[model samples]
Target: MEFTTALFYVFAAILILAATQVITARNPVHSALFLVLAFFTASGIWMLLKAEFLAIVLVLVYVGAVMVLFLFVVMMLDIDLDKLRAGFWSHFPLALTVGVVVVLEMSAVLWRGFLTVGRQIHGDSGNIGDTKNLGLVIFTHYQLAFEVAAAILLLAIVAAVALTLRRRKDSKYVDPAQAVKVQSKDRVRIVKMKAESDRVTLAATEKQGN
Candidate 1:
């Protein structure tokens, strides 16, 4: 077997194992860590496939950003493992069935290209060329789909923020508009004390005459 082929198989095996562990691990943090490992291995596989742009993006975006965020969130949550596992056995059968179906579908899709004969089809000729081509395709043919996906992701971020931001009636919060509209003239009062000065002068004169 070629060295590249052997390395490909190794990376693929690692990715599969890590993905399985991501779902099977009892600890949420461990599962998230395994998912990060899976992303790394997948990126390696993409690199081997000559999709350098996709590979780098997979590592930078998913492994570096998304998985780190997931790890922090998992660690922060006060999760009860026992409570989580309570219905595991009850859900196992259905989950297993779904998993099998998914595996079969993936196998069928991959098997479709099994007998195809070709040299290593490099999606990206080189580092710079690949990025330019990727950007061109993304902005041209796939622009609408990309925009829709971005919109969906934006909605998800907004929903997550809304869910985490709890309203407290006792807590004082400033309204930005009201604060911006406030003026110094509305806050300070300038009162004239002309009568007080005249009264003081009259009292002083009366005292002096006495």
Candidate 2:
């Protein structure tokens, strides 16, 4: 077998192992680490496919940023592993059905591309993984779709913020309107009183004791 094919198998094996560990690992941190490994291996596979941009992005964005964030969150959060596992069996059937549906859908879409005997559809050969070309194509050919996707992402962000900002009894927040309208007198009171001497304080204390 060719070196590239061998490398593909190696990466694929590592990816499968890492993905399995991601789901099976007891510790959330360990699962996150395993997911990072899976992303790395998947990046390698993308590199092998000459999708250099995708590979770099997978390494930089998902592995570097997203996975690091996931690791930090997993490490910081107090996760009850038992509680997490408790509902797993209960949801297994639904999960299995969804998984099967996804697999079948993906297979249906991708099986044709995997066929070696049939005439394969060739893409632009000028620059296989050129970021410039990719950007131009996206901006020119799929500009509307891209803009729609961006809008959708923005909407999702807004929705997420709205959801998290739901009024809670425990959440302490200041009203901006009230804060802006507040006067110095409302915030602070100046009580002009005579400063008593320590001797007077002691006499007062003694009198109180008596």
Candidate 3:
């Protein structure tokens, strides 16, 4: 086997192991670390494929920013492992169904690509690592598909925000509409009190006279 092929297998093996550990690890922090490893390995695989832009982006965006945030959140939060695992069995059926559907969809796409392996649809064959060429191809040929992906990403973002958002009794949040409509009278109350006599002055005057 060629050295590149061997290197590819090595990266793939490490990626698979890291991904497995991400789900299997007992500690959340350890899981986050493994996920970071998986991202790095995947980026290495992308680099081997000559997609340097994607590899760099995977490392910078996922490994550098997203994974660091995940690590920080996992380390900082006081999470109950038992409570988190309690619903795992209950949700397994739904999760499994979703996983199968995703796998089938991915398989379909990969099958189509495999069937067209010999055909080179893009005219520019030399610019493999050029971001400009990639952009041109995406914008010109796959514009609709690109727009659809962007819409899907937007929907996913909204869904994630909606799912994670909860109103906690212990948490305090202000309503922008209410804040904008607030009046000074509602927030502040003025009270008038008569000044008390200075008994120390009276005592000093009495002492001087005595």
Candidate 4:
């Protein structure tokens, strides 16, 4: 076979192995590391496919930003591995069935494309700097779709924030109207009470004792 085919197979193998490890690793940190490896291999495959922009974005956006955040969250959480694994066997049958169905679906989809050869992406020529034209095409033709996606992403962000900010018994909330009306005098009180001398108080206490 050709060198390109061999390279593809190597990257594909790495991706598959990493993905499997991501699912099967006992430690969440290990699983996250495996997922990063899988992303790397998938980016390599994208590079091989001449989707340079996509490969770079996958490495930068997913690996650099998203995966780092995910790893941080996983590492920060106090996960009880035993508790996590307790229901594994009970859930295994359904999980296995779903896994099998997914595998079959993926295999069916990929088997057809796996045999296909290369073509120009977005009708652009096989040039190195086609990303600019591709972006122009997307922004021009799919402007409405892009805006819709942005709106959906904004909605998701709002939803997540609302959920995370759910009021608990101990949660302190400030009234904006009260906050607006507050003044320095309202916040700070000047008490005008007479102070008793420590010497006089002591003398009074001694007299009382006598």
lDDT score of residue 162 within candidate 1 = 88
lDDT of 2: 0.87
Candidate that scores best on lDDT: 3
* 75-181: candidate 3 lDDT, tens digit per residue: 88999999999999999999999999999999999999999877754638645456777888889889999999999999999999999878889999888999999
lDDT per residue, candidate 2, 1-210, as tens digits? 999999999999999899999888988888889998899899889889878998899899998899888888878889888888999999999999999999999998798667753663233554546677778778887899999999999999999998888777898988899999999999999998766797799899999999
Flag regions of model 3 displaced more than 4 Å.
121-123, 126-128, 138-210
Could you estimate the TM-score for every candidate? 0.70, 0.69, 0.65, 0.71
Model with the higher lDDT, candidate 1 or 3: 3
Where model 2 places Cα greater than 4 Å from the true spot, the runs are: 116-128, 155-210
lDDT of 4 by residue, 48-81 (tens): 8877888999999999999999999998989999
Candidate 3, 186: how far from true, in Å? 28
Cα-based lDDT for every prediction: 0.86, 0.87, 0.89, 0.88
Q: What TM-score quantifies how close candidate 1 is to the native fold?
A: 0.70
lDDT of 1 by residue, 1-210 (tens): 999999999999999999889888988999998999999998888888777888899889998899889988888889999998899999999999998999999998778778554444333543432777778767877899999999999999999998987878998878899989999998898997678889999999999999
The segments of candidate 1 whose C-alpha lies over 4 angstroms from its true place after superposition are: 115-129, 151-168, 182-210
How many angstroms is residue 164 displaced in model 3 relative to the true structure, after the best TM-score fit? 15
* Candidate 4: residue 139 Cα off by (Å): 1.9
